[model samples]
Target: MDKSIFTTNAALTPALGYSTMIGLGLFSLALAYIVRLYLVRNTHDFIIADRRIGFGFGVGSVIAVWTWAMAVMMSSAMTYQWGLSGLFWFVVPNGIAVMAMVPFARILRRNMPEGYTISEFIALRFQQSKVATGIVTVTMVFGIILEILINLKGTSVVVSTVFSIDWRVATIVGIVCVLAYSYFGGLWTSVMTGTLNTLMITVPAAIVVVAVYDRIPGGAEAVFSAVGAADQRNLSVLRPDAAAGFGITLAFGLLAATVADQTFWQKVWAIKSRDVSRTFLWAGALFYPIPICLGMLGLVGIGYGLVPSDFGGDIAAVGPYIVSHIGLPLTLILLYVLVILAACYSTIDGASAALSSIVAVDIVKRYFPGTSESKLFVITKLSVLAGGVIATVIVLAGIDFTTLVLTTYALKTSVLLPLVFAILWPRTNTIGFVGGIVLAILIGMPIYQFVGELSGTLAIVAISGLTVIVAGLLKPQAFDIASLKDANGATSAPTAGE
Candidate 1:
């Protein structure tokens, strides 16, 4: 619980942090524009990269977009707070969330090959009921907004801490950089930058662990001893406290969260069909090391006698605090900068693309049907800009990032089961999809806040499924899956170079 040990050390300074931010930011932005010159030419290219994305970019997109700053920072914080078992609880479910998307991605591509957003598919599915589309649109929008806001908060806070810069300044610089690259190619920009980000995070993370190994008081053995001394179950995968508190809840929460994300769904439509399953599976497997490796900072902190309790409930500081004290060389300090920036930028650009896709396809075109593709493309770019600006405003307004994310996710669990069932089950009707989600939002959220996350999430998902089942029994409206072939206007255009 003492902080005096870190006071004398200086791994990085404000000037270095600022230099890294501007240099990396400009380089990424310029690279995005250059890639855009070769790829982006139409709305089709912007939204889904002309549906020709290959295995490498697809896997990179999956890994990078999903590796938000919260994952990078909080996983380490949780490890510091809860011990070894904490890594398993956070990492496994996160992977399952992406892996679970494999089957759904294939199904979605088959059913709505030209789909712009999942909300677009929902609209096509329940043509007679506007409520379903409305539900999907509203939730997905809020989800993307909260997604961007939280990552921005995480990035700015970490950058501010390490660089001794103003959080507001860090946020503006980061958002502007994200907005620049994202404006160039939309989804193409996201995938390109994401690929770069994946390399940035993975290599640096591996290096940091190896570099810091000797700094631990007694090495791995000492770290393990401290872990057990803190709590024996810290080394076990089945920590009772973790399971009851967050393990199961977070698992289901991430499942719901990923299912409800437009960013992942966008990739589902973007990747080539033959490669969909492989891409998702590879991403799932590769994504594990990011959070797990970063978590060593926490374990090493434990070995060095700095635990979460020492930070006075702000466990988010544990990662930077560890790095600051360990006497990291200049190279490792710069490497740490890339890890954080990449984590934040990847998701930020992905969110921009996802929100713009929805705005252009679902909101703008749906409301103003006569708009031309050229006009829609312009609107989409503007939406990307607007999404970045709005999230920045929210972060600057001083909202609590964690609470905003939790609130957005609480709404998603209410609708997740019905949304999934709507895709998989023939008996799911508009009545159930609409009414169940509505009631769950009204009722389940209160329970989530006052009762418990696990109980509330389970209750809402059950209520949603039950409502659909009951509606099917009462007045079944059989849906024709064959109709989905024509659902997204027409068959998708051929892939680039096909």
Candidate 2:
């Protein structure tokens, strides 16, 4: 592919990119301050928003956290590669993963209403077994770190590509901006800002999509025909290549990403109990269009006969390439940058908040029973700062996005079935839960690297599930689900009104 054919005559100024980051940072900081002053009374309110978030914010937060940088970039990249099939395979599992959380959220919330982290729930469920708790806590921590790293990486890639700025500077600015707000308001900051961020992402994205179609010759139909003429497989959603490339890997990987990620679990407990299932359902439904629309840009790239080299040897840059090169007005181009920024900010803050929950509830509260509430609160905020620093360091290391994503997915997948068994099945014991994750990590990850994604993912799930079953049958010990209610010794603080 001739990269010169796709070169843009104009690019965004570094001034615009840096100013946007600084402006959004100050705005988020102000928003967090207001929220803290008016809504937050103590550690509980800061960490989980007093477990009273309503449907609107709940739905918005779920969508924002799920939207992250990878979703924005990968959806388009996949479509650029596999056409309609890429969009189909990438999007279906993405939505399904969020919706799948419904039942689990319902069950866990009813049983343990004061839960702050999944690791905390597992600790209680497994009767305080150190091995089980340690495994889950480590995974949750790792998951949040990966979330932060990926979002930072995503934002850096987009900003640097469009503005011709250094990616390292973009990453540093991005994480610092997010931490500025997130460190103050915690989950409250995440949910409230996430609601606003959702609008930032969707509205601009819709306009960009319409503008792109209007600008192209003969509109959507012409693009469709161009893609089809290039390759019939591009138009077919059920093409073998799409399924082989994205279907199996994303199906399992995305599912694990959602089910195992603490970001969703934080929302599960933060929202009103009655609103849990509906929020997830609505969020999942609403989330479908954002990715699908952004991904069309990939199809636009394909129709234009642009390849990875056209986007600086990175297919993930295809979305930005089409937006910047297609002769859209400067205003629309900036709005597209806002879309990427919003996605990155919401998820980074959300993941940081989730990490705070784990540090306070799973590690501090669980291990240091005598810690004061004031100290615990400070530690929680510090955790966000610590997470941002750690993720920033790793992003500076310049790891491959796809490799990091797949590896995180595999690690998360190793524990998914075990978590499910622990939640819904009474016979699921610590031995089974611990053993399942241990064996999956030892056996499944190597296969993932050496053999194939589909096969390795299947092995992880099967090994984890089967290990739980065999252990359960050999040593049938039923856990009392109702006991979880009393086991939840969540520390409370005064409400804002109190």
Candidate 3:
């Protein structure tokens, strides 16, 4: 491995960084315009695409939303730091987490066919217990906000690092670009743009991975030798050390992220019922190669003996660092940037779309009751704009990407068991559901922040799970699940296609 390449600070010009952001933003705007011109006529079309999305679009949207910028950066960083075990721990749970939502989505879509948000269902399930519904709503809102912040933060860090642009400028540009399109077509735009973004992410990623490996002096074997020499465990797929450190934490945390998130739930309603299971199954399968390909860059970093210091002491910067320093052609470098930007753009728009659903159905409609459909429609778009502004402000505050991700995961994980019980178990009562989440937040969050990640996550799941079970046993109440059919009130007439 040549150490000399590390000395030169090679980077793309700031113009390229700004241009990429502007270009993607304009592209998303075009998609939104098309959607508005033809598809989005009301809140239903805007929020959930009239609940008629088919398999192709559904699969693409799922893959795009699931491929967050953090997934690209962190997958490599984990492998770079913890070896193959790190990649295994991160990638396996991630794919499975999305697939795990299949049963939940199937049941929820069947039971509450007209539902728009998970929190809305929680309200109905708990007999509209304000405390229980509020907990889930707040958890989801914060989770989505964190989703926006993390993707923005990830894009900013990568752009600034590889293009010599200021992180603040990158952050603001990324959010504004996403909001420009997301505000117009809502979920319709998100799905259309998300499918395109999926292509940008997957195709470019495969090319870059092969290019990097081909460009290496000793090729795959040399890279392997270099990595193995540093630490033999880097070659092992089943390193017990990584399983203990990353396996348990990511397994539970990632599952919580998918199940508790309104993003997946929004898709549940947006997609056709028959396509739901297969869409998720294919989406999960399609998602595997992305992180796997990106994780190889972590090995490339190790092969070249690059350390965190080379990338400003940020492990999450490993992917960008490799792409910039590895001497790839200028075209491939730009392609790599497109991949990151695409991941960031797709997810930001997806989260914003989900946020709009919550605002329209859960908050504004629920509270204002008499608010007209026209007003509800307008409020939904406005909520997305508001979310973009809030997320941008927080990103400018300079929070660490890893810290934001872990904290958000912890918060989401706290509600995992309680939420699952609410959806699946008839005996899950309001007292248990509400009490479990409250206790998890009150107790588990402190441990998460102050104690260990694993311990904190475990504590949250344990506390919430125990509370729900005990409450159910003590005060067993078989909720009339059939009544949930009318939970969202009178269903609107099906749109033209449906």
All candidates' TM-scores? 0.95, 0.96, 0.96
Clashing pairs in model 2, backbone N/Cα/C closer than 3 A: none
Ranking by lDDT: 3, 2, 1
Model 2, span 1-498: residue lDDT tens: 222434463647899899988788888899999998988777788788989999999999899999988788888899998888999999998899999999999999998887888887887787778888888788888888888998898899899888888999999988889999998888988998999999999999999988977888788898888888899889888888778766987798778888888889989999999999999999999999999989988888888898677678988888988888888888898998899999999999998999988888888877787778788888888999999999899889876567666656766998899998988899988888899988998899888879987788888999999999999999978788889888765433222332
- lDDT (C-alpha) at residue 221 in model 1: 79
Model 3 worst lDDT window (10 residues) = 489-498
Give the TM-score (vs. native) of candidate 3: 0.96
> What lDDT score belongs to each candidate, Candidate 1 first?
0.81, 0.86, 0.87
Query: What does the lDDT read for residue 217 in candidate 3?
Result: 84
Error of 2 at 10 (Å): 3.6
lDDT of candidate 1 over 1-498, digit per residue (tens): 233645524646778887887787788878888778898887778888888889999999899999988888878887876777788888889999989988788888887777668887787778736778888888898999888888888888888877778999999988887888789888988998899899999998888877777655566777788777766776777777877778888887788778888998888888987898899999998999889899887776665567556543578878876775567777886788788889899998999999987887778777786777777779888999998899999999886676767667766887788888888877788888898888887788777778997787777777877888898779787887668886545422222331
Residue 295 lDDT in model 3? 96
Off by over 4 Å in 2: 1-11, 399-407, 490-498
Clashing pairs in 3: none
